[model samples]
Target: MWDNIGSPFDYIAEKYDEDFSNSLAGTLQRNRVWHFLKEEIKAQKPLHVLEINCGTGVDAIWMTEHNCEVWATDVSANMITIAKSKLRDNSAVNCHFSICSFNQLEKRFEGRKFDLIFSNFAGLNCVDENEIRKLNTAFFKLLNENGRLTMVLLGKNCLTERFYFALKNEFKNANRRYSVALAKLTKDVLQPTWYYHSLKLTKLFSSFVLIRKRPIGLFIPPSYLNLWLNKHPVITKLATWLEYTIGSLPIFADNGDHIYLSMSKKITAK
Candidate 1:
């Protein structure tokens, strides 16, 4: 179902960590994700997790380290290969990796259920609202009662991106999120991407009740700015501080480069 988007991800599989996962901006944004992940995990022991678009399994490793049983999937075979290789040394970790696309979840894991369903870093943005609704229905059935779904999504308007691009006199790049566009994964690889407003995204997942949501890079900027931010350590430090200061404010919480949104399955009487 996602062959066009999934295959292009293969082009970046090898350098994904170097280009984004390990970049300074990526680290800060991910740290904020971890904060919410920990909060969800602390209440559920012997947790069972299903991660879609796992992307080399960094978060899968963290889940296993916390003693959670994890089944991580990505659409790209190259990505799953790297993820599986990374776990070879930790034979005891209860983590599994496989190549599966978002639309294939119900068919791929028919009888399986999970305590937590996770997708990070705008992976959910690969599809449109119709696909999202299909996913919402699948999630309702795949989740255990009270199970949680957490996603990190690119927001429609990013303050940092606007200022960053505007200063460069690049209005098109600054407003790219406002329209549908193909994001460049590599010089030759481009993938369709969609940006969402927090409320718009919440409405798409109608089956789940909102748990909490917050801005991820209100002050930290987007990962693409990592190179410049890394060169200015003091400015980066200040940005991180400012993020923690106001990232959670209701007024600014939904307007960042990315938004962390969590929701819970509603248990209805049979």
Candidate 2:
């Protein structure tokens, strides 16, 4: 979906943060995702981070503030420009953003070794399983001993959500995007493939220690918050309260839009 769209994220880059920095759903989703991620960062030594498809630099800024050295990259030049602008006024002097995709990693960062590797929002889905599987070999050489890799991946539920969203919005142009995504999900076949399964994701990366999996979302909702924010203030308030109240409850965490995975590199031949 990413390569086909060539950074549709660029279409919303400037206002991405503004879209949901304070909404109940946004706050709850990010809070859960980052909170779980921070635990791993805190457990390990101060490390360098390599974030693939770093969207608009929001996460990059957060990482820098938490004292991690950040090298953020995306395939979109426009997204990189936005990231560079966000870094302009920040104190994460250790941060840098660039335009590089997974296929181009060797050409751009030939000898770089990172203490951690990160990507957010199902960026790994942008590539195929075979290619993504190949990264273990590439990253193994690039990671310091016992480094960690963490990311927030979009879940299969997003497809159904998108379907209902398009149906609710009733937009004529909605199906165009939906069809494209569905096609990608099927890979031109009859079946669909989502990027991660909490258990299977842990298994796929089992060459490394399976640190933990925390499902995000499971309760709140997706980006449609703009549809309900002002019309029903009291209802919104109640919803917001419910979100925060249940954000950390294991039963409710993964119901949102994304999930967090924190895995550490292992030293052994398994």
Candidate 3:
């Protein structure tokens, strides 16, 4: 079954609080996201920021609290509505919301260049590399000189790959039960739209200079394992601690599903 035919983002927004925003996995992973963003985000001069596929307002609210004048958007109206409701209490003059698709950013913002352009999680994965490249060009056009472009995406290979493979019944249809569980219980993320190697991504955005290449899920178990890990919170904590100890280490980190890829506009395009 195709994932995009329905309003997937809206479906997610409907359950964002239960599924992610407040769960143990969601709480832990979001800590990683905001911690990393704080270092890169600048709050000077009413800087403009654009969040693509800004699901359910989690990051949008966080940015507002941190002093960024955020112009948040999502393709799904449902998501935008829910996210806006979440922000009703905050009076951040800089925070705004809209509905716009990734391919048509200019329609929503005419001649507005942002100080920062960002997308979180697998939002960039909604389309394949062709879409990523196209968005990169758009990011180039919409950014101020020396602007930063950062995104967190799921890499092609991870423990999730094994899970997806089992669903595909690559090991013969004997694994149908596991596949059915993944399809019904979780987000139906089995149909992969975008997952790429770091080197390939570097080339895809070679126009921009990659400032940092590192892994995010190195020590953390993927979200799908949340249930199993729930029984062993201390052990999970220890395992994640061990994982963090090795986080700075090489190739192993890259193998995880989610990685943070950051870059800066290094050249003036002709």
**Which lDDT values do the candidates have, in the order given?**
0.87, 0.65, 0.70
Candidate 1 residues 122-219, lDDT tens each?
A: 89988898999999999989999979999999999899999999999999998999887899998888989988998987899999898898899999
Superposed model 3: Cα runs more than 4 Å off: 1-6, 42-46, 159-192, 249-253
* C-alpha TM-score for every candidate: 0.94, 0.75, 0.83
**Structure candidate 1, residue pairs in collision:** none
Sequence-dependent TM-score of model 3: 0.83
The list of candidate 1 runs beyond 4 A from truth reads 1-6, 88-92
Instruction: Report the Cα RMSD per candidate.
Output: 2.7, 5.9, 5.0
Q: Rank the candidate models, highest lDDT first.
A: 1, 3, 2
Measured with C-alpha atoms, the lDDT of residue 36 in candidate 1 is 71
